[model samples]
Target: MRGKKLADLNVMERIAQEDDMGTMTKDESAQFKADRQAAQAKYGQMSAEEKAAVRKAAQQKRLSDLNTMERVGQENDMRRYMSY
Candidate 1:
């Protein structure tokens, strides 16, 4: 379990693994803790529609970022080929 890759676990399992590991990095762990606490505090005040909108926006941003990364990767590959 100690040496297991995160890719091998499902979401819940990966969360469990992270919890078991306890310290990902001091700064990261503290930031995550703060973020979770903030989200939890804010979530209770949000309406259902607001939560849905936030989720949708987050998903769209994630997809947009992924597409941008793919395009950049393709451009880098082309540049490498041209240079060679």
Candidate 2:
């Protein structure tokens, strides 16, 4: 049996494999990141559904942190308004 070629992998899988390879030098990694950033910057936009999904995830994360913030703020308020 023959082994599969690296080029045969899909985009996401190829990126993952590159990540696994661990051979990319710091300069190469920087260039790859810059290229990706430039590509995203040029006429980069998300669909309504994608935007909604991101917003929903962010809202969910914020909701998870709400209780922690409320506790901290309540504690601060109690200390600020404390009577001697």
Candidate 3:
């Protein structure tokens, strides 16, 4: 009987399996720190109700955009079948 062997995966799988620590380059490290500080300041100013409303609005916009594009794609596909 032959033994089964597992296949070696790519770097992406390894990265996903491990924790992130000191993985960024110098430039990325600086930018990430700046972004984090900026986000903390902005989020600190928003009330809980305002934050909830903003998240809801973002979700609604994404859903609406997805629906609109899906409709446009279906229309285009239907036209292809109906043409003489």
Candidate 4:
């Protein structure tokens, strides 16, 4: 696995790639920090109810995007969990 290219990784291996912080490139880290700051600024401007609504809407959209197997896995509390 040490010498394997990203394209050669399996589905679970590809998914696990996100768990390795060293995998992030400098540009990706900068972009992620920028995005997070923007989201934090936006959230800080929202009221309590507005925040709840926004979170609910995002959850709904995420659930809708999942396929049957993923949804079923979620319902069953599988090892592979979805994140927001």
Candidate 5:
């Protein structure tokens, strides 16, 4: 797990990596499953335009997060150089 990227991990391995307790409580797991099913049902009822909008929004959010991460890395490098 040390050198493995998230995409390289299998589903259970990824879940293990993300969950510090290594497993969810039974109630929490049940709630999560119900939420997922609900979301799937809602999405299934959405029109194609709505689905595309959702995907576009998600893509935009990912791009925004990537930009923020890159900016933070650059700032960290600047701070390190300035301290030298």
Candidate 6:
């Protein structure tokens, strides 16, 4: 895994890349901080209904992404088992 490129990593591998704070690179941490600040700024100006909508949309997107990641993980597992 040390010499592998990001493109070569499967979904699970990519996700595991940021498993903990100690594993996160400085650039990744900076980008994550910037993104969070931007999201907070955007949310701060929204009306009540707009905030609710945004929250709901965020939840849905999170769930969808998790489902997709899970499916990819399952596919990877199946492939590994099939090679046995």
Q: List the residue pairs that clash in candidate 4.
A: none
Q: Write the per-residue lDDT of candidate 5 for residues 1-84, one digit (tens) a residue.
A: 779888899999987877766677999999999999999999999999898788777755654666666867666554543342
For 1-84, candidate 6 gives per-residue lDDT tens digits of 879999999899999997875678899999999999998998898999897777667655654666666867766554543342
List, residue by residue over 1-84, the lDDT tens digit for candidate 4: 779999999998888986855688999999999999999999999999898788777777877899998888777553233342
Q: Can you give the TM-score per candidate against the true fold?
A: 0.43, 0.31, 0.41, 0.52, 0.56, 0.42
Q: Candidate 1 clashing pairs? A: none
Error of 2 at 9 (Å): 64
Can you tell me which runs of candidate 3 are displaced by over 4 Å?
A: 1-24, 65-84
Per-residue CA lDDT of candidate 3, range 1-84, in tens? Answer: 024222454566655556566577999989999999999899789999888777777655654666666867666555543442
- Which wins on TM-score, candidate 4 or candidate 6? 4
Q: Give the least accurate 10-residue stretch of model 3, judged by summed lDDT.
A: 1-10
Full-model lDDT for every candidate: 0.72, 0.67, 0.68, 0.81, 0.77, 0.76
Candidate 5, residue 36: the lDDT equals: 100
Quick one: best lDDT, which candidate? 4
TM value for model 2: 0.31
Considering TM-score, which of the candidate structures 1 and 2 is the better prediction for this target? 1
Angstrom error at residue 83, model 4:
19
**Model 6, C-alpha of 83: deviation from truth (Å):** 48
lDDT of 2 at 76: 52
Question: At residue 26, what lDDT does model 4 achieve?
Answer: 94
Off by over 4 Å in 6: 1-22, 59-84
Residue 68, candidate 4: Cα error in Å is 1.2
Rank order (by lDDT, best first): 4, 5, 6, 1, 3, 2
- Give the CA lDDT, 0 to 100, for residue 44 in model 6: 94
TM-score of 3: 0.41
lDDT (tens digit, per residue) of candidate 1 on 1-84: 656677777788877766744448888989999999998989889999898777777655654666666767766554443332
